[model samples]
Target chain A: MSLEVNGHKTYAYTGNHAFDACLPTVIFIHGAANDHSVWALQSRYFAYHGHNVLAVDLPGHGKSAGDALNDVATFADWVKALMDAVGIEQAAIVGHSMGSLIGLETAARYPAIVTRLALVGTAIPMPVTDALLETSAANDHAAYEMINVFAHSPRAQIGGNRLPGAWMMGNSMRLMERSANGVLHADFTACNSYRGGLDAAKKTKCPVLLILGQRDLMTPPRAAKEAAASFSNARTVMLDGTGHSLMSEQPDAVLDALIDFLRPKNVTAA
Target chain B: MPAPKTYQLDTLSLHAGQQPDSEFGARAQPIYFTTSYVFPDTDHAASLFNMERAGHVYSRISNPTNAALEERIAALEGGVGAIATASGQAALHLAIVTLMNAGSHIVASGSLYGGSHNLLAYTLPRFGIETTFVKPRDVDAFRAAIRPETRLLFGETLGNPGLDVLDIPRVSEVAHEAGLPLLVDSTFTTPYLMRPFDLGADLIFHSATKFLGGHGVAIGGLLVDGGKFDWDKSGNFPTLSEPYEGFHGMVFTEESTTAAFLLRARREGIRDFGACMSPINAFQIMQGMETLGPRMQRHMDNTRAVVAFLDKHDAVEQVVYPELPSHPDHELARKLLPNGCGAVFSFELKGGRSAGRKFIESLKVFSHLANVGDAKSLVIHPATTTHYRMDDAALRAAGITEGTVRLSIGIESAEDLLEDLSRALRASQKA
Candidate 1:
């Protein structure tokens, strides 16, 4: 369940390939600092329950190649091209944090291509603090810590701070070091500059889902709620004790929500 | 100097919602951080609770800081009154719930923020209410979808991520014909670009977390009542017209004429839901609102430059910005958001998803975050992100492809933004 998208080989993991051919596809876009591996649990869970799962390493973050882009539009263009390359005419997009914003751009620009959207741990036009940008530029350690603070639940934070998770963070940081500073800066800059709201959410003719970690400090649940308000067909689900890394923190819950969303309705038998 | 009769947006942004504090002569609206307001007497408390007086009762219901924000937004939106909520979703939920009951129905635009889409598509159904989604531009579709049980029509003034401009007037007409009120979520356009109430909407809602709270320091929502709809005539909104057991058996319509809907919303809806805006968040949003007009201008200018650059990019398969003639909704954008469509647009790469990923990875200026309406630039791929909940068929139906990337242009220097995009495009092609 994979294809070469835009000359770069892309991988898709469909847990259940025998589902109805007419079933919708669920595409997973990981965050700025992570790769498609972050969605391993999600892909398997959804695929097991009759879904066509597509998890991609946003170029430079995972198995994908190259460096980060400078502006937001180029990233969006690249995604559009990838969609074209995969021969996936369209699908439901779910993005976390940075991925969520990218999903917004894709749905907005290619309304004809995005049937539904779920923005997790992200807001329309994310707010950036100077401290955050400074940390990303000067102190990778601080940046990682800040990101973890924002992404993990308070309980996870306390737990991760103690033993195995702390070691895991160390490993993650080493991997994140390979990510170019340019990409991190551009991602934050794009988030800082993005201007999305109710008006923008209104134009698309599709349903939308928003998932937020109640304890997320990075892109707080409140912001997700605000962004969700703009859509006529939108719902907000705040996972208690969860943070920005909702897929990792509550993978089963996220999968269940997606499964429910992807389940075809009677459609009034039209 | 005295304030000009008609101040520009910049001037309005600074002074629109404020007056000198009567006791301290404070220039800025001071934050009244207290949770409860003291009453003059038992009679005064009764009067306030009875809707015969105008003042704060509890911070959870309303507060001085939150009230200042409500007034500021109401003045900016030219609405009769406003109620600030804990978050934008609460505002939307309260708006819909205020007008319709469990058995009622709604006709909504299909293009929507993921959270909102889920709320209408899934959660509301659990409450015994159902929604029929239609294209925002298809007035006929909306009209055709309306059922006898449909009590309200809803659409975003501009769609999320899609950046599609809604035909507010046309849709409003359709709703009015059905004796229904049109609720427009004006989060993106704000009062600066397009005022939904002025454009014939019965109500407006905003997720103050974005542009309104430009700094991203706080999260809040506001609901504005246009006082344009005649609930008595509609007969569909009994909550506003009928007696309520929650508020000492007071009838909202009889107690408050212009602010009946808002009053009922605060006294009953929010009280029961407990989705109250924190005074601290309200204060932070107020600070953001003070700079909204200027920030929006920069966002628009930057967006135009970015759109132009993307339109000419060699790797770009297409650019979908309403301001560009190439956009399918360009004409409609002109009619609606003539001042300028707010900053946010999308483009597709010629190289497909891999190229899209490479380009995203190649960025130097734009952050690869998933949020929009920031002071900085952002980029994302939709097939892998926001719309991933939909299966392939639904994705095709919604128009999302693997190579599609969504961009939220920031207020960075246009040259910087352009250079970043150019480099990424080149990198994407090479990759």
Candidate 2:
């Protein structure tokens, strides 16, 4: 469904169902060079089961209309505005990689509105290499290829997608290729330049779950230490043989962890 | 900061999509022949149906063996995703139906396979989809034929029988200018000779029964999505962009940035059309693909020797092969098909239709049949067999004559193939 977030039209996949504000909400945010489609399986599952799901296309990234935001804080603000536009009082925010940072910031800034947070393939101070930054700035196709290769594990390149016949590596490359010219450069820069991870971690009040991919080179599991230590009620799960694309590479495991962590203690599926 | 060593085509061909069986540790790809997978509980069933997970539910939608073929072919073609269908005709039909509805039009090349020609000219029109057949060589003619309802531009990589190579880059330019995707049948050339995606084509289909299957034991087709075309930007493909009510109000383009076509093709087209490939067939094709690269090289080597022998033969009036200077698309083929212009090409016999039959009867090695891309050499007289449905003008347009005898060179010894063709030509002269 399309919403008027911050006076610009925002596109969110409603998990293939009509939006219902009556139910508890779950918003799935994708990483850089991607949109709601990255969370295709998870979001659809959540919406169909019990929750109201909103897998969004960030500004200028996909179906949404607007310029790409220059920093992580602005992206967080947009997420809050999206909730308001959709009449969602609070949502359990689930984010991946770059979206993980946005989820952190949103939890920090909007403590009352965020009931819980789940971060997948995340780290404090997510850093981009100088070479990747330079190549991305030049809008070179090599930058896309380099990241795609790095993002996926060697096993993933051989192809066993949970979704049969879906080539994970090839789809990742094409999604990156589909992004607007400055989106990747800006996204990588935002990840590189942001110095607010410690501050956001300190201010965050919601229960947090950190899901790390064991073989993730982009944001190594060890890199989650500082952020994990900051959260008073944080629980961490490390998946075996998984990569940065944890949602696709280990979809069932990721879903199991997220669903177990997010579902209310007393409530069961009716 | 070291880059990982990526596997090459041959290694990927053998191992890309297949994993050792987790249950039995079977080394080769284990064909899962079951009709449906069991769900653990109701929620699991609901989740699987809702696209919450990626595992298969029913064989008609997807099977483990078929998924392996789909991934292997996608890897070989340099495409984002693919779907295996009942046959080459099913693949073509799936690709078209996924993009078009009643009243949609297509601008297609005149030099197409006979079955494809029949589908576009007679079959599809019965359902309100119209097609304008343009000469594959005329780039401008493709652009000129587009109507407001035109959904795609299509051609074969190497034109059937004639061996006229379609200029993918140029035709794709015209298609892109009008915001349409170029869909090509890459059956003749395969990825070994040319990857149409790299050359600017957006979608490709192959008769796996031919080259990819190599042994001609399986009848299956594969449709690959390059994921290059922007359906949202095109504003020409609402079937992809708009919310489809049939499948839970899913706006396919919004579901996956690169894979909307395959998603819809599998979910709706395959589900409703019932033109799904069998897991056994997929397994057979997977075996053929393991040796595709090396087999293609041998096919090319033997094809060159056969073309050469046929060119200078007394009873052969014209040897139509792109590698030959006299062929119209020779230069284009040299540019696009550097590996060779594929194994299949036609030659006109000096003794009309009667001689064509005699040559077929005279050949000891080459089997007389209607199919190409078999490991064993094959021959077909198109005027009476493949192109029998077409009238004289239609035959002329496809570059077929009463004496046109098509040869599909095999990976056999070049000396043997040359000897076989020479003896056949000598017999045709006497007839």
Candidate 3:
């Protein structure tokens, strides 16, 4: 779906369905140098099964026009602007990696607008390695190469992708490759500069879900404990043999966990 | 600077898409012979059919065995995804129909496999889709042939019979300039010789019946999506950028950033056209594909030997192999086909069609067959068979003579192949 935010054209995948405000809303945010299509399966399921899905491509990343935001706060504000533009008073926020940080910040500062939050492949203080930062800052293809190799587990590198025909490694790499020059650098800089993840987790008043991958090298599950502890009411689900690109590597598990969390019959919202 | 880490081609060949059978602990890939899959419940069935989930609904849409081979080929070709079809022609048809409709046009190489030529020149026009043929070497002709209705630019990695190297990088640039995607037939060269995607081609298809299934036991085709083209930005591909009513109003490009072409081809083309690869054929193809790297290397080695032998023979009028310095595209072939040109080549004899018949009848070891890329070396007189209907003028236009003989050198003993060819050539001259 196309919408205007801050007078700039913004592109969001509305699960191929016209957005209906009467239904419960779910906004899916992607990680660094990525776009709305990253949540192709996840967002579609939500849209079909009783929710209005908005998988947004952050400004300047995909079809969205305007300069890319430099930090988590600005991205959160843009998401707010997007929601406001689309008349979504409140919605669930589900994000991955850098997007997870944006979701955390949005829920922390704009709690009224966020109903629930789900973070996938997140770290408390998301730090960019010096090599990666320098490489991306130079707008070098090698930066994407490093991330592609590091993002997946050893098994994913060899390939047993559940989704037919799609090669996980190639698919993930191609998405990141679509980012324009210096856009990837801005995304990494944003992730590296963020300091409010733990604070955001603590400040969040709504129910939270942490979806970590066991073999995710980008944001290893072992490092998620500090942030996970900060949440007053958060559930953790670690997927085995999956990497940072868990949504693509294992679509069903990610969707099932997300669906079950969003419409819990047993566990009420905190 | 660290290099991008990826599995070697040989490694991917043996193990890219298949895992050990979780049910029976079988190491080999098990064929999912069933035509349809049982859904868990109503919701799961709805989700699968509605494109909300990814799994096999029917063998026509996808099959486990076919998908394994598809994934492996996509990996080897550096593509996002691929679709396996009943034959190479089916794969090409699926690709063309998914991107375009009636009244669309294509700019393609004039020197193509006879079957491909038939499809573009004769059959597609019947459906209101037209194609303008351009010389593979003439990049300018490719650009000039593009009309407003042109949706695609296509060529073979190695032009049939002549081994005319289709300058992919140059042709793809021209295609991109015109907002079209370059589709190349990688049947002859395969990924072992070159990856078209790496050279700017947006799409690639293969006759897996050829070198991919090196033993030539089964027939199948693979169409791979390079996943780099921006269909929305291109402003020409409404089939992808706009909502497709045929498949639940799915805008394919919005569904997957990298695999929009693949999604449409599988969902709409394969589902409706019903030209899908059989699991049994997929199994046979995979069994041969497992040793692709080594088999291709041997094929190249043996081909080099046969080309060398034919070049110096007394009965030969001329030999056409890209690696030979005498060939027109030798330098380009050296640059583009660093691994090798291909295993197949054509040579003219001193005598006419009668000589070709005598030569084939005299061969003791080599088989006289219509197919190429077999374990056994095969020969065919193109003038009498493949290009039979073409007049003498048209025959010469395609670089075929009355005595032109096409040879598909195989992984046999180089010495024995030479002896057989030596006898055939001598017999041809005597006739």
Provide backbone clash counts, one per model: 130, 1, 0
1 or 2, greater by DockQ:
2
In terms of DockQ, the best-performing candidate is 3
True contacts kept of each: 0.00, 0.72, 0.74
Cα displacement (Å) at residue B8, model 2: 2.7
Provide interface RMSD per model, one decimal: 25.6, 2.0, 1.3
Q: What TM-score would candidate 3 get against the native? A: 0.98
lDDT per model vs. reference: 0.72, 0.88, 0.90
**All models, DockQ values?**
0.01, 0.62, 0.75
The complex in candidate 3 yields a DockQ of 0.75
Summarize candidate 2's per-residue lDDT along A1-270 as a digit string, tens digits.
887888888899886677776788888888988888888888877887778989998888878888878699999999999998888778889999989999999998888888888999998889999878988898888788778877887778798677889888888888888888989998888788878987898888888899998889899998989889988778999998888999889989989988887786622221
Q: Model 2, residue A1: displacement in angstroms?
A: 2.3
What candidate 2 gets wrong by more than 4 Å, as runs, is A16-18, A266-270, B1-5, B387-398
**For model 2, which pairs clash?**
A162-B54
What is candidate 1's lDDT per residue for B1-431, written digit by digit as tens?
11113345565566644556768888877888898878889855764554333456877777777776776676677665677898999999999888788899999999888778899999999999999999887889999999999998998887865777899889999999998999988888888889887678988999888788877678789888876676756777788877677765555554433456776788778878879888788778878888888788888888888888888878888887789897778899998899888877778788766787798899999888766677778888876677667766776677676678888777888999889888889999997
lDDT of 2 at B40: 96
Candidate order by decreasing TM-score: 3, 2, 1
lDDT tens digits, residues B116-209, model 2?
A: 9999999999999999999899999999999999999999998866777899999999999999999999999888888899999999999999
